[model samples]
Target chain A: MNGWLLAATVELGGAGAAALWGTATGPLPRRVMAQNLATSAVCPALLLLAQGYGRPSYVDLALLMALLGPVGTLVFARLLADELLDDRPRAWTLTWAAAGLSAAVVVAVCVATGPSRAMVKLLLIGALLIGGNVIASRALAGGFRGVRGA
Target chain B: MADAVIVVALLLVAASATAAVAQREPARQALVLSVLGVVLAVLFTVLQAPDVGLSQLAVGSALTPLLIMLSVRKVRRQARAKDRAR
Candidate 1:
């Protein structure tokens, strides 16, 4: 409808398509990496959708996603450690790219929102999104060797 | 015009769902399913149902994959143990 919604649509469409393609037809490590990236991709789109719809409450979805997306990736990282131990998937470029994209989106939204509690919430989501993403990617790369089996 | 967002979300959901089903390996299928979950959450949000979207994000993103992967690991472990016992 508006610019924000249009942006959200484009982002969701592009990233979702890429994620689907990557996850659907890839080796184990690549698929895991794609799954991790999906969280980063969709979280920003959700933020944009919240702004587009003019409903701050919708941001809760982004927050939950920021929190949970990596957990899912970690789940795979831990359980599939046997399969991935050989390849040790490392996509630092893609990880940082998604992190940067999320940061940029959050900052833009915060600037539009100005100083307020909502801005703080936006910052929190952004922090969680980037931090969780990096940690998940690291785990996938076998950074925490001790956490492999459970 | 404005409906483009909805159209895109719908298409994503359809594609990801099909991908999830078409995958052969359970572990790989779980990976696709997790992506499907995120895409579905985005679709829900676009459709103006954030409440459902929130729950979907919680369940679909992490929980489903965690459960599936865990079960796969358990089954594999048990099968290996059976082989060792024989």
Candidate 2:
């Protein structure tokens, strides 16, 4: 369809493949890391889809992804903490790359949207996506001392 | 073509679902299942059903895995308790 949709397709496909592979056959830590990256990847793609479909309402899905994707990863971090005690899963490169992509997508979408309430919403989703991503990554790497299991 | 995304989404769902089934451990299965949920949500979106996709994101990304992991943890704790009692 449109370029935005096309970009969404490529991003979803590429990131989805890497995530599936990483999670399907690896150590538990790697699997969790893959899950976090997948969330980051999927959120931006959802935003792109919303822009491509010309449906501002669809943006809610991306917002939800940005909000909840990290929640899922954090769930694993908390529940699997004892299991992951010895090995900390850290993927700053992939995490930062996904954050940058999301930022790019948000900026592009805002420029296309011009000065409007929708642009502000897009900015909010971007912040949530990147912020949640970092938090989730930090959780997986055992960054928060309070988060360690008893 | 417009169909490429649809095709990609479909293939991801199929592949991830199969992988979910293939996983040997419940924890690992839960992990794969989470990925499947996200894939399914994207598939729904690509098919022009963001409503379904939205709900799927809510349930699939976090809720389902949380439920599964909690259940697994409970069962494991019960088993350990029984072992200690013996």
Which candidate tops lDDT?
A: 2
Clashes of 2: 0
Each prediction's RMSD over C-alphas, in Å, is: 0.9, 1.0
Per residue, candidate 1 scores C-alpha lDDT tens digits across A39-106 of 99989999998999999999999999999998999888878888887899899999999999999999
**Could you say which candidate leads in DockQ?**
1
Q: A1-150, model 2: which lDDT tens digit per residue?
A: 899999999998898899999999889999999988988888888888888989989999889988999999999999999899899999999899989999999999999999999999999999999999999999999899774545
Candidate DockQ values, in order, are: 0.93, 0.88
Residue pairs in candidate 1 whose N, alpha carbon or C atoms collide under 3 angstroms: none
Candidate 2 per-residue lDDT, tens place, B21-69, comes to 9988999999999999999999999899988998998999999999999
TM-score of each candidate structure, all chains considered together: 0.98, 0.97
Superposed Cα deviation of residue B13, candidate 2 (Å):
0.4
> What TM-score would you report for chain A in candidate 1?
0.98
Ten consecutive residues with minimal summed lDDT in candidate 1 chain B? Answer: B39-48
